[model samples]
Target: MNYRNLFYALALAITANLGVMAQGHKGPAWLSNAVFYQIYPSSYMDTDGNGIGDLPGITSKLDYIKSIGVNTIWLNPVFESGWFDGGYDIIDFYKIDPRFGTNTDMVNLINEAHKRGIKVCLDLVAGHTSDKCQWFKECASGDRNSRYADYFIWSDSISRKDMEQIRQRNSEPNPQASTRGKWVELDAPRGKYYQKNYYVCQPALNYGYANPNPANPWEQSVNAPGPQAVRRELRNIMAFWFDKGVDGFRVDMAASLVKGDPDKKAVMALWQEMRAWINKNYPECVLVSEWSDPKKSIPAGFNIDFEIHLADKIYNTLFFASDDPWGAKGKECYFDKRGLGSLDYFYKKYADIYTSTHDKGYVAFPTANHDFQRLRTGRRYDLQQLKVAMTFFLTMPGVPFIYYGDEIGMKYLPGLQPKEGSRKRSGTRTPMQWSAGETAGFSTCKPENLYFPVDTENGKISVAAEDNDPRSLLNFVRGLIKLRHSSPALNNDGKWQLVSDHSKPYPMVYTRFVDGETYATALNPSGHSVTASLAHLGKAEKMSLTGKVKYKTGNANDKIELGPVSAAVFKIR
Candidate 1:
């Protein structure tokens, strides 16, 4: 079919399907085809010459972000923090970090973003707070009767010997150890120990335990006064931001709120309550969780959840493999061009999660985030291979979040010193390269003063250079995002079905159904060309090459021949 004819057919099909599925539950209406761009504020753009990125700096770059065809922006934590955990160790929830800008700057940012039709989502660190926070300080004052004393988990006085025993117990493989040695003893009048969720500087807040143990006085019940007070404070924080024009939040460590509940029922209930409050007060606001389990997080009222970097073998199989220079240890990822990885692991988990949450929420697939390496990292340095990965990411049936520099094929600098508690992840959080000039045009400040050094070795990858090249990864990603926005069959609510066998070595085939039309997509991540038969699945008639990939179709038995590191889409008329 001609391009014009195809457009008209799609429009009619979508109109017809909308009538039939009007009653069916889908995620938020605005998120049907929303493309999200994640920006680490400290690394995105530096305008004040203070060696750090700020809110005004982000506001100045809204035009560039909008040009990439993304409608949503997820900013990493900009709250007042000690910079101990890269802004995750928030010291004040209501204020923006001084390094980033003032609270007024954030308000201005939200205004400018909304003017450009872009929604802003701030990162909410709800699980813990910096040890230097006022609340934690108050709790650590040894005043048992202090109003904020129970805001954090505090245990009775423990001798040095007892603390050592607790540490030993934590070191051993004891699944029955109800209270692990996640505590630190404070030298104060009360002389109590407090629990920490992550680093020693981040103390876990008192959200209460799912199953309280009398032996551990710190394990307060969910209904306890302290837990109730914490819930109220969470609501207040959300309301504060919602009132300031912020559209939503991407909650950090969402699943770790409640302790000692393997089933996570209490944590789920806590979020449900928060969701209820959000719906009633800020109806337009949305909530996305960092929780990797969509089956549990979606039902708990999270509008979306990520499917990246969490102990999931399927996730590692698709992106991180043993041979990957940055990865710990594993087989080759499916897109490594090695033909050694299988999609069964990913497909099975995805199917189960999708089946359970298709009506309620979505599972996001980010190109990469601050906590993980970029798509072009390690052995997968070829831009063509990245195009294939982008094909799968953009065409999948969920929200697609592109990390700031992923569109430009940014490389993860190896062996960089840690910054703001970013140990190995420091490489991925490098400043965005806007040009090939000094400092990659990321900041006008001296190179030594940059928040994080730009990739200067072997010539930096800059946006200006990529903008001039039509075949560059930047332009290719822009094309995929534009296509996703214009096609209902590729939206977040589309139904996904695997057309090729999971055991296939190359040319992975899948069909996305939506608006009464079928969109078949094929990806070949292998080094050589390969043909796959789709006759057993169904007729995929109208074929079209999408992105920067190369492919050919055969009429005999509905087979498709895909070139190395290529991807294509078919209308399936």
Candidate 2:
């Protein structure tokens, strides 16, 4: 047989081994095992003098990310979009946003990430396009008799009189007519018409399937009218990026893709189609759905799991205003949102769990990203208290994501409220403060035009400044992440058992097991000492820690004395 024929034969064999014939359970293997880091490209770093972080900027920081041991990167939208939504509202899927970089820049990023064994996953906005997108404009203009006219959801028309009558019937006792209109006019020049709607800039897409005909209203339904057309457009976009070498996609607002469906079969079909198409062309590529709903199921076409229990876990405790472990009595710390639930409750609530991301409200302790406020700035936890949060998150069974600059204890100034530009770009998106340098070594752009301003006073708080400080929070986080990577029992998929629920307020203890190995982790939630018993477990091995020994196992002092909200990990044989 010729070499060409041999190549075809090998490809078929590889596909068969990957379980392509099995529809329900077969999917990519790397997903469950891989650790991911979310990158806010514009805020991560700047290689050019434009003061905006771009593709090269991310390329330059790969070493820093890799140093933390993550193998996957989930970047927020980098596609062409009006700068207002921070890249979520996409204008064009095929092109890169100018502020981020060019198409070639993205290709280069994929290449670089691949070389380091890291996968690149872009934000795929499958739900809605920015009102500025060309397709929306075409639909408004009635140009070329848009095949996409029904692709977006539109409300039926009713005259001003009918609207007024409906409002009168629904009016409150005060007779306030809040929504006194029926058909709202499209703001565009051609359509020059309106529809009663939601999120003026975002129009919903059609998820039904039928062809448009005056006799059939269902024919005008977005999905009913032309499911293939919409699917083809999205498929083409996915293929475009796949050919450019993106490893996968993290679909945006995925649950909204198919609205008003009881079984969720419409969206599930879309995902299944998208998944099937990608697997055919790029077998290794993964599709991660972002389903914000707590009851989210593994959609028909999804290769990896998505947002579920992890959201409430982090927001309700780590970043919530009620969670401050060290808040002054009668008044909570500015951001403590804990005690609404416990860490064990968060872990036990899910049958399956996903651990990190950039979409969180604040730094997801043990990991932080650029989308929210910096961890140091949002919460006032002392270093010791901070370590407990970190140890708990990093040592948990799934992948751990570390935001840029988090390892070295980056801080945003408190009370630096957000300004008119991109939401609060002022504080969290500031440049990586390497040292007390001019402009924190972030930009040559005049300080005023920068996407964000420097966070430190005289730039004193920086990576270089804290690197040499032995007691620095930066070093503490690094030590924890390094330790997590060192132990398979701590980092791998495991069965976690809650061993103690002592009546104490803060210091907590738990054990995790995987592959015949057991790990015991203890955490202190306050600044003072709190002791807990390790009485039940037999024959203890050595404990892992940095400072002088304040507690030990199996001794006359069998109590674990945690130092002022600190934490420690011990491996018992």
Candidate 3:
């Protein structure tokens, strides 16, 4: 064989597999163009008339999901669970809950999703287990010598006051500080107390604490026998699923492990161990984190992580967050239609992360996740206003997740009765409205039997209705998603830079550039119109949500006038 021919073949193979193979640790190659749709399993659909979304139900919608340009599906916790804390409190790591389907159903779902070029990411609760879990039950005995007695953290001596003292150590910038956090007691007085990650029923798994104090005997070292065993089991759990053809996992509360590690060196080390194992065994699999800290999580072994956690006020400033979360209503969010909001704060936070880590990994921004209010909630109710927001979500840098039903302008109905443990979050997770049928195309069961109530007020907001209207939010989202997938500069690895003055953010502008091609996106989500001189950015066919984007040649360049709550994208230098 000629040397030139062999070299050409090698380069071609590497180019084809660049994202996953050539670029090690960046993420799976498929993720470069992946757009995620997060499905709250019980609320997506009910195929068996059991009033709960199942694996088969998701399998049935693969076509619809693909049509909307979603290439990845992040299914929230489908494993066996006690249903407490909305499936975060896992019962069995190996078995799929009968409520969702069998383990084989999951394998089939993965096979079917892979057929459509859709990757499936299951939610992995790596931190803890429900009190009902056999591991928890066995360890709850407080028997120090039992096989699984060390699987979870246990203490019969430390008091609540001491727990508070432990909480005070290295706890300044923490996000998961809820009422049930820190520590909880055994329900039936089992002579032992255990640490709690979220709810009382969920006991924290012992991955070891970072700083093992001599005073706190319950604190185990990161390399102790118990912690070492837990680490092996985590790998065992992941390998079990990976062997069944699962793509990857969205690790829940990823940063909440290795307690007492203020700097989180130990927690990162634990995941790094997991990542190394995955790199060797399942190189194509990816790991996204709920850590909300891209700076740390990306380097710590996650391929992708959240741009902002709900507790972080930075993201809150862009959406429906108030300056004082407990005291007031939402202030001037950039997406709100009042013309009072600005993107300066959010842009600064986002740009810092992008500049530092864009090449190493990605940061994810979901339009509205399980913990967030929908885009159509409260003062942001107008559909045109939402269109502007959707345009930004689709065009922005990094991987984006569209919550199910948000494409059809789903409403966040507040004050609904809670289910399982979804208190206020219940409103954000109502069933998907497939049509205007009697049950909103969710389930054949009676309305009362649903996981929660489907919005009766959203009678005209079903997918069937929106699919018929080109101007509907659903159709607009579909078009935007198609544009994102088709555009070379808009994929995950593209460079993002603020295209407008940060101080004057009314007409928020940004550019995504890759492979020497550039595109500019401008948005005016305020109640009033604004004009900006975008001379440097030449022009191309405009992809817009409103007709208000008027252009005029001013001297040397084009000046764009964006109308109220309008958005447009143009190809430029």
Best by TM-score: 3
Candidate 2: deviation at residue 302, Å? Answer: 3.9
Q: Which stretch of 10 consecutive residues in model 1 shows the poorest summed lDDT? A: 15-24
| CA shift of 87, model 3, Å | 0.7
lDDT of 2 at 534: 62
Cα RMSD, model 2: 8.1
TM-score list, all predictions = 0.90, 0.78, 0.91
Clash tally, candidates in order: 1, 24, 0
Where does candidate 1 stray beyond 4 Å?
1-27, 157-162, 165-181, 456-460, 536-556
All candidates: CA RMSD (Å): 9.6, 8.1, 7.6
TM-score result, candidate 1: 0.90
Candidate 1: residue 484 Cα off by (Å): 0.6
lDDT of 1 at 99: 91
lDDT per residue for candidate 3 within 516-556, as digits (tens), equals 89888888888898988765666555765564787564557
433-470 in candidate 2: lDDT tens per residue?
A: 66665567666666665556666456546666666676
RMSD of candidate 1 to true structure, Å: 9.6
lDDT per model, in order? 0.81, 0.59, 0.80
lDDT of model 3, residue 210: 84
